[model samples]
Target: MTNVIFTVGNDMRADDGAGPFLAALLEADPAAGWEVIDGGASPENHTHRIRALSPKRVVIVDAADMGLAPGEVRRIDEDCVARHFLITTHAIPLNFLIDSLRETVPEIVFLGIQPREIVFMAPMTDDVRRGVAALHRTLVDGVGIDSFPGIAE
Candidate 1:
């Protein structure tokens, strides 16, 4: 049994790159019981990957414009991800995909970083960078880690 974390985002949009950025970090420390997926720009299309892995608990990280101050952090559950997380991956929105995966992946969780700037292809803000660093530490410590049968698939 192992856990999987899916970092989803668009690299062009500054802080929106949180997911992929974290994925890069996690990929470095790939010991036993860890799986990192950088589902960049197109998470919905990666249904096969999710299904294939079938993690017990999946943590989806992203930057969302949640009307909060820059660098604010909010942990969203599966049901609420569509309402808060703002991603420019594809025509089909996150909410749509979340709803579709609800029955299939009832244990998915969301970790959102409130981004002050979503400017195209920009670098991440200092605040978001620090917050991501903090989150990276937490994940490394297994703050949200859990066991799943197919996570290693």
Candidate 2:
């Protein structure tokens, strides 16, 4: 099974950029099997790209407004994501896309990093940066990708 992950967010927006930054970090790691996509705060634009890959496991990383304490990272399922975050684009809502696709695709999951602020033209806040780092550690050192097969080494 092909393992794929998509990072969608606007790097210009403080905490919102966490997604793209994490994507960059994952891309830099050769052992992490993922497709880094700069969704730029909108996932709609990348729907086609995802369709082309047709991965078995699809993980969408983004900054969400779950109303939790800022910088909190949560791995939300499809049912909860829409209620928490608007899920603007990132290729036609993974659930909807999956329904539309006749061919069997991959399992889709969402990992949302709570963003303190999504304001324009600002760098990442310290809390958001720390959050991403901590979250990455979970997926890397903790889960170790090895347990996930294609996701790690």
Candidate 3:
């Protein structure tokens, strides 16, 4: 079964760039099997492409304000996504995108990384960078998301 990763964020923004940064790393890795889509600030625009891929699983990565320390990562449950993602830069609600994808994608996971800053054109904070790098390593190593640091419920 095919698995796809949809990264949502604006690279121009500081920590909000986590998604895209992770996307770049995954794309360059020759051993990575999942398709990576850097949705940038408008992941809704890529809905058609994701549907076309017909992936069995779709993982959405984004910078979220989960009230946690900077660089913390968590698997945000669908029902709790809106609660944690308050400062969104996307054009539409992520929950909406998830709802739309549910029709075609059997499984959807939202990976949220707590961001320290999201200023426009600012460099990503070290904390968030480390979080993104950890996530990248987890993906490239084919490790379960549950094994990632700060992933506990």
Highest TM-score: which candidate?
3
Alpha-carbon shift of residue 125 in model 2 (angstroms): 0.8
Residues 1-153, candidate 2, lDDT per residue (tens digit)? 456667777787778788888877766663255565655665656667777877777677788776667777776756766655743534455445434432545577667777777777888999889887776666656374333212100
- Model 1's TM-score against the true structure: 0.81
Winner by lDDT between candidate 3 and candidate 1? 3
Per-residue lDDT tens digits for candidate 3, residues 40-111, read: 899999989999999999989999888889988888877777655646798999999999999999999888
Model 1: per-residue Cα lDDT over 1-153, one tens digit each: 446677778878888887788788778765346688887888887766776776676667778766666766676655555654575655577777666656566576667777777778799888888877767777677654322111100
RMSD of 3: 2.0
Looking at candidate 1, what is the lDDT of residue 37? 82
- The C-alpha lDDT values of all candidates are 0.69, 0.66, 0.86
Clashes of 1: 1
Off by over 4 Å in 2: 87-104, 142-153
Candidate 1: give the clashing pairs: 12-121
Regarding TM-score, does 1 or 3 come out ahead? Answer: 3
User: How many clashes show up per model?
Assistant: 1, 7, 0
Candidate 1 stretches with Cα past 4 Å from truth are: 84-89, 145-153
lDDT of 3 at 128: 94
Ranking by lDDT: 3, 1, 2
